[model samples]
Target: MTHTRFPKAVLFDLDGTLVDSAPDFIAVINRMRAERGRDALPLAELRPVVSKGARAMLGAGFPDVAASEREAWVQEFLDLYEAELGLHGTPFDGVEAMLAALEANGTTWGIVTNKPEYLARKLLPLLGWETRCAILVGGDTLPVRKPDPLPLLHAAQAIGVVADDCIYVGDDERDIIAARAAGMPSVVALWGYRLHEDDPFAWQGDVLIHAPAELCETRAWPGTGTQA
Candidate 1:
């Protein structure tokens, strides 16, 4: 995974890696629980599952619900989340500056997340990333999603960059798995949501960065002589 030059493109995971959407999830789920006369869970209790997506969050919020019932509640949760998408969420610290740095260096950057396309697109405009992002590949954009190389490969193709010429940054193991399968180098964003049981080292990302600011330094990137 050595590289003679910096990556031509940088692809990011949305929820946890680029945007700190945990606040939004916390607000929505708590509000939903309140409406059902259920006690609100602590924000800390739910934050870790944010990267795991809606189902996990719902399960945490409604622990007694049946699996089939929880599945039904997912759409309800998504509906609530969409109505207030960017109201409570903001990009992770320094994400905008990192993207700007990449742009100034002539490196195209985009998003490849497990979020649905509609919601992903909706959130971008709210964050003023509509024009800044070179491409976006949502979970449902293809038949497969993260942990599968197709979405990552498709994003590279859409941006006219070879898979090997891209670097994928995400907070989850699935993100690393997908990048590895795509033959692209990857960085694990340690600042993102994760449970106590989660282990970034076990994920084996090419680099582990504690914040988006680290991305501005080429030496901190994978294939740049940084430790994996």
Candidate 2:
């Protein structure tokens, strides 16, 4: 096996990449829609924008509403969801094991998610991961977020790893963009929540992981004697 140059650290996105928070998010979206006398969207429809933030989900679920109205709806959605956060969310299968593998290998791992820190922190304990993660950089942790690279850079700094020595794994384009901008290698998580219109293979990350467990296998990491 060809040995790929393994990174010293791996930063992951929380919502879709590490945890299956879509169900929890959908529940909140539907609740908000119901309160507004509007019909709730099916899980499939809302799943598409799970990574796009509350604003995108609000706009998609309330397409007939004006932009200003949507903004208010978004705020309401966040507020409501925050109250019931993590009720239906859980880490993806093999997530704990994967994290363990990283720890065993002496590689640092952290979370750099677009989710607000309070909400993200709230979920960590339920998954029994509150203290395991080396660094937790949330949407509110810094002034900027994914697709901007600042969060990724900050996470790398917090984890004591350099951009080139770290890999960022996420289920969205923003994750790849952030990794690229931060000069880190990235993997597209195919196992996470994805829209029907999206294509992980074409997202152009360093690698495309098929499942959560696959990540723990060093063979999947390029240059680790794994195929490119």
Candidate 3:
């Protein structure tokens, strides 16, 4: 699974890699809790697991609820969130500039996320990325998803790139695991959300980007080796 440096395509994890979606997530979780006569969680408490998906947020907001109640609450949170998708989310700092730079250099890029297809599809339009992203592989797009390597492999195939010619950027351990399994290079997005005790340096991705702006510096990307 080894290869030369500099990938042809860069795949991103949506929630935390490309965008900081914590505000909207916090709002939705809090709103859902309020509806159930519970106190809303503060931002500090909710931001850590924003990239972990709805279940994590639901569990954080309703830790004492019965499992059945938590399931229903999670569904309600999703429904409410769908209506407010992208309301407070935005591409991370320098993300837009970095994407534009990639486009100018003819470097293909796309999204591979554990977010559900419907939600991911809905958010793209709001962010005006409906036609800009080269490809998108949602959690449910295939029989398997991230941490399985199948979805990441699918994204590369769909974009006409070999798995080894793709670099994945993500904020979670699953992202690195998937990239390694798929034979792709990977970067750990340091600006993304994580628990207080989480360690990005130990995640062991090929690169670590502290700010989205750093990504714009393609020639000097932290651990990209030399560009191809």
Best by TM-score: 1
* Candidate with the larger lDDT of 1 and 2: 1
What lDDT score goes with residue 52 in model 3? 83
Q: Which digits, one per residue and each the tens of the lDDT, describe model 1 over residues 1-228?
A: 433344578899999999999889988899899999988888898999999989999988888888788898888899999987999889988998898878887888899999999999999989999999999999999999999999999998999878887889999999999999999989999999899999999998989999899777767777622221
Q: RMSD, each candidate, Å? A: 2.8, 2.7, 3.0
lDDT of all predictions, in order shown? 0.88, 0.82, 0.83
Candidate 3's C-alpha lDDT?
Answer: 0.83
How well does each candidate superpose onto the true structure, as a TM-score? 0.95, 0.92, 0.92
Q: Per-residue CA lDDT of candidate 2, range 62-98, in tens?
A: 7788878787666678788887788887888998888
Off by over 4 Å in 1: 1-6, 224-228
Report model 3's TM-score to 2 decimal places: 0.92
The TM-score between candidate 1 and the true structure equals 0.95
Residue 110 displacement in candidate 1 (angstroms):
0.6
Q: Could you tell me the C-alpha RMSD of candidate 2 in Å?
A: 2.7
**Each model's number of backbone clashes?**
0, 8, 0
